[model samples]
Target chain A: MCTGSEANDLALRVAKQATGHRGVIVTENAYHGVTTEIAAISPSLGGVGSLAEWVRTVRPPSGDGTAMVADARTAIAELQAAGHGVAALIVDTAFASDGFIAPSAETRAALAAVQALVRAAGGLVIADEVQPGFGRLGARGAGSGAAEASLWGFPRHALEPDLVTIGKPMANGLPVAGLVARRDLMQAFGERVRYFNTFAGTPVSVAAARATWDVLHDERLPEHAADVGDELRGMLAELAGRHDRLRGVRGSGLYLGVDVVDPESGDPDTPAAVALVSGLRERRILISASGRDNAALKLRPPLPFSRADAERFITELDGALGDLG
Target chain B: MCTGSEANDLALRVAKQATGHRGVIVTENAYHGVTTEIAAISPSLGGVGSLAEWVRTVRPPSGDGTAMVADARTAIAELQAAGHGVAALIVDTAFASDGFIAPSAETRAALAAVQALVRAAGGLVIADEVQPGFGRLGARGAGSGAAEASLWGFPRHALEPDLVTIGKPMANGLPVAGLVARRDLMQAFGERVRYFNTFAGTPVSVAAARATWDVLHDERLPEHAADVGDELRGMLAELAGRHDRLRGVRGSGLYLGVDVVDPESGDPDTPAAVALVSGLRERRILISASGRDNAALKLRPPLPFSRADAERFITELDGALGDLG
Candidate 1:
């Protein structure tokens, strides 16, 4: 794998090969990757009606475990009826594109139900950790205080995914990614097919990944991020109390999302989100908006971002909001 | 693009977007890249019947312009009958996997005719130069001494491909590739889609590409390769005169392929080729075999392969052949 896209693409290939099916299920706003096959299943890239015929989309978990399960069941049935038996259900574990869904018991249960339904349909579960992996969601079983655990750190009892795609922060900047799956599944695919990509597993790229991993562990970056993120969340919550436009702050660790809304109607304010992002850029503190409506301020800084850096970011954000008002 | 696979993948996407068609054409044993969609069009990957429904394969040029043109026409007609309008025809200009076909006026005319037929059906022409680009085929219009020019150095009158994918040697080994297409075709695709790869065009990768280009020009590697390749070709032809198993040597520059055949039948001899490759490896001289039958000794040494190095390779190959006998 050379990128998150390649990892996801390989994962899909493996799932289809292992299950002998073509149907795929993904969240309505999910973004798995940019490859041709992955892009077909990534609805966030091209909105509704852009998906491949073998693909079906379900709403992201919204606390109703039964409804989410029903949605997965329906998607599986639809695919089956269309002659494409269910192959896999892939999702970004952090729900980054679906406005960064908060980690709660209900949300977790919904996800669990969906996973069960997909498995019952003989489909594999793929956790795409391109966004939330590499300690961005904190250490394993650190609990809700650290929010959702990305694939690499997810507790065993929480979810048992068949395949996990990891990328983005793996090699820091060099292109490198990988798909982790059960030995049997990999062996099955390997026996039937040969997979090769130029520049994949290059010595230089692997060296970079090893060094990055060493640095992360040596510096205890995950714990550091957890502590600084908690502080940042509290600061943002405090600011929300002062500003009516600041709806709420959600997400875990350093990957927080701040909702910007219209005070009058409580609707997402895309213009204000745009203004604040531009203002932050003007102040030389870069940030961007995410979510389907692009109204949630996405704050994902370097792993080395410290408490002082958090304070500076909060102060600048506060000033920008005030100026906008 | 971060790799040749990604470049070819992007080229397919752009072609489909620009043409609004689904059908693809490729050589019978062609290997475009490793991406799923590209692999489907690459018949050599999984053999016959593994091609996507929208993909069709044609015989590569075999020095008969009329026959090659007929093959292309038949493939296009079949795809059209299957309701998949022609989208594009992608080929490795070097015919690398097809055993490095010697460039001749008949072969060039055959390729041109195929291009004309594909374009007439509203399909784009994609030149995959991952294996032959970056001065590997020498400067444009250097004739048979230079062989078929790759996209990066193709003479203007040779062929006007609609899109070209370049990689492998672009940045030395830093995983940099690119898709160059007509402005309007690119503009149309960009309007309907957005393409982004995480590590594409990174500063370090671009710096490497720039430095590689500077060195190629400063040392005139293309010209150097052409000169040395001629000397190597003469030596290999002399070897063929001595050994009945050596059928012939073909290709231009350092990308030469020596045909290994059974002395009695004149048919491809894969075992002899394999034995020679292993013998070279044992001597710490690395090389591999190519062609559909894996009977052509692929000698794509570095562009810096000197005359003395060629003599050494030829001497070792002579000894290896003698040992095999």
Candidate 2:
């Protein structure tokens, strides 16, 4: 069993301990976890605990996927030349909490590119899928959109990582997760010591996951998430364009980010983000900041959140934006 | 809530972050957890992991307790004077995973004294109650002793700490824990950033704790454990002087450890310890090596063990020890 935080920690540890890799790689504005290891790999995102010695941050990819992929290659060499061996490449599947932003086609390919590089460098790749799994990305109320596209557009299918870490809604808060690796790594872990959590494989949490998956599949929440996500993005776009403080919209499926901005320069708007998030809470819609300093509003409603809820959220956001004005 | 490993990790994090201490002070033979923090803090404990930076070890007390405590004091001063902050004074209580070997009273007193000095120097102290809490020490039957003792120990003694993390059997195998801090610290954490875990506070786990606690208090297991522990120790003592390999006993309440050695050279008889544990397991009593390379045989039965069971265990142990001949 792994907390999203622990999953990341063990991921780094596995890389460092197993392959003799000293250089750990992460991405800008990426969140690993609240613990020391996870935060260490993340740069200024939450790396305040003086763990930079163990991390190398690659700039997050923007429009061009190839450049993003190239960025990973550069990071590996730089780290290796600096005498720190690259052990593994760590990537979060979607920038869900950071900005609800999914990687571009080029960025996804870059992820694949680096996977091969890291493996040749005697490193592994760990994909963090905590938020996207369990059908949160395909809610129907969001309007059928790109999220429901074929395997090519499917976010998780974008990369075939060596290891995958998942948690959160896996058991609907029942507290269970698995650090599933390829047969080799799993055997290595199993051979050294059998891993078991007292509460990890609990019958109760297992039951919860089974029940939750049934509900998700039976109701086709993933498909629904796509519908709601497309519609929500359309509505959010109008809000972002109309308001001077609201920046561009990022994210796909139901995982969305309402980028707050500095009214004057349109730079990262930390204060605006806080105001809007707090404002949403006052209006009785739970939402909070995503990355460092509460710079982006994270909107991760349950998979079952309906269109009415989305409309109501946008309506309140419109009013909240006006109140700030 | 937290696991034994997490509890230990958080303890050190508080110590270092709170005290500005970089180096950790540990006993020569100690097992903290399976995480990086614990591994850094406890290097001598035998596990798959290796040593980490900023860790300093000292030999355990030699019955007088003076040697070890003095070692700690001297080590802390040296580390601090050399620009290392002695953030917190951390130690497993008298009996640690080192086969429940209880330090002498003097050693215990010295530890508390050094911790007080460290606290005076602006550090914290964390008591890892994961192994012994909730009636494990005094428990005789299926969680009755340990569980009851833990509940009453905290609420009754007013052993208020700056922080306390409890997990592992909190839900009888449910992944849940409580990171209890003084209101101020928790408030500070909340103020800086909101913290939430999907599975850390599972309702089913909560229910299990409630059920476990209910059975504990209702069954009067603590008294039974105390009653049984006394009997078990006496039997072990009678056998101790009789056997050339048996040296001494460690721990309190129901948690007991039999010293296995030539009773003369004072060197650890690791192979013998392993044999006895394996033999016990083969005989259908599940146990493991407690600390430091199978040096001490461990026996932690469910809380609801009975006097008849203890008698049976004694018979089996005598047979196993005789087989060592």
Candidate 3:
């Protein structure tokens, strides 16, 4: 696999083969990848048609996660009724497009319950960690060392998926991606399908990935992300009190989302979010907005981002937010 | 696109959108790519099931290509009858898997006719040049410089395709691939679908591709491939006259296929092909077998392969063939 899409595509294929079914479940607005099969599951890549008949989507995790569980139950029932039995439930553990939602206690329970429900429906669980993989979603608070942090999002959420898809930060800009699957499931796929990709697992790619892995652990960048992210979030929260449009801040590690809203109405302010993004761009700070209404600022800086860099960004963001008014 | 599979996958989607049809035509044993959609059209990646109902395969181009056209006609009729109207006809111009078939006069006519027929049926023609692209199929004979060479395979046969897919050599070993489509078709696709992929056309990847392109032209590697390939093919032909097991040689420029046959019965000798491949590997001259029966030695050396390297390979191949005897 040379891209996250290819890895997710293969993961779906493996899940389908192992489960002997065709139905797929995804979080609403979840973005898995760009491949045909994976794209169909990614509701965020909207096109002329709805999702394929074999695919269903549940509401993204929020609050107590009860609504999401209800949506999942309905999706499962609909899929079963349609005769396309459940094959897999693929999720981006960070729920990035769902506004980089931080985990709540009930959300954790819902994730575990959803995993069990999918398994009971004869489907595998695929954790797509392309956005929150390779120590990006470090666990413990600011002062904790890298050794104590969870390197991937699924583990942080206590998820034991049958397959895991990783990419993006893999080779630190080089094209390298991979699918990690349970041995029995992979063997089942290998017995029937001859999976192949030209640029996958090449010597140079593997060497680059290994080099990146070495730097990720040796320099303790994950812990650095956590420490700086905690400080950055605290500053953003302080900024939120000053700027009424900055509704809230959420997420963990270096990945954070700031809800942009109308000051009076308190509704999602997509125009304000767009203006804020452009304002930040003018200030030489790169950021984008995502979510159902595209009104949440997505701030996922490089792993080695530091407190000084964070302060510089916050200053610029403060200026940009003032400019937005 | 970061891989050939991605490019082909995008091409298929674009073609389907432009034509508003679902049926796809491909050569038997043709290899498009590994993506879920493209793989369904590639017969060579054998698995448990047949091609999807919307896909139809024609015989690979050979000797006049009449049989191939006949097969195409039947496939078109079948698809139309099945309510899957023609969307596109995708071909690897070199026909590498069908024993590296070189175009005959009739074959060239057949190609032109097929293109016209596909367009008449409201389908686009996609030339998959991952294997035969980047100046590997020079038009003029040996001793000619780079100017006269057709740097791509489709132009060698004077076949105008609506889309062209390229990979492998674009960025040397870096993961870079692309699909070149007519502006009209691209615009049509743009109006309907929202296609996106991460790691496509990044600055570093573009820089690598540009550097490779500069060297390819500055050093006239395609011209070198042509001149060296001409001599290599001539030498192989002479060697074929002496070796009883050597049945015939096909292909042009640097990409060639040598058929291995049982000396007495003149039938394809798959075992001998496998043994020759192993023998070459043992001698540190890596090569592989292709074609439906896996009895054709596929010789696709690096573009800069010189006369001296060809001579060394031939000497080793000669010894390997003798050892087989």
**For model 2, what TM-score is found for chain B?**
0.83
Candidate 3, residues B166-228: lDDT per residue as tens digits?
Answer: 998888877889999899889888887767777898666688899999998788877788788
User: Which structure among the candidates has the greatest DockQ?
Assistant: 1
Which sections of candidate 1 miss by over 4 Å? A140-153, B140-157
How well is each residue in A164-274 modelled by candidate 3, as lDDT tens digits?
A: 999999988788899998999888888888777778886667888999999987888877888888999999999999999997798998999999999999999999999
* Candidates 1 and 2 compared by DockQ, better number: 1
- Give a tens-digit lDDT track for model 2, residues B1-325: 4356655665565545545567766667666666646655665544324445455566654466567667777777777777776665555553455445444456555555555655665666565566566665664344644444444223222223456556665666666666556676555545543234455555777888888767767876666666777777777777776777766665566677766775568777888888888788789887666566557666566667777888888788888889988
Candidate 1, residues B32-135: lDDT per residue as tens digits?
87778887888777886778999988887776667778989999999889988899998888887876766678887888889899999999999888888887
1 or 3, which is superior by DockQ?
Answer: 1
- Model 1 steric clash pairs: none
TM-scores of chain A across candidates:
0.93, 0.88, 0.95
CAPRI tier of model 2: acceptable
Model 3: chain A TM-score against the true structure: 0.95
The Cα local distance difference test for each model comes to: 0.84, 0.66, 0.85
Clashing pairs in 3: none
Off by over 4 Å in 3: A47-49, A141-149, B139-149
Q: What is the interface RMSD of each candidate, in Å?
A: 1.0, 3.4, 1.4
lDDT score for residue B115 of model 3: 81
Candidate with better TM-score, 1 vs 3: 3
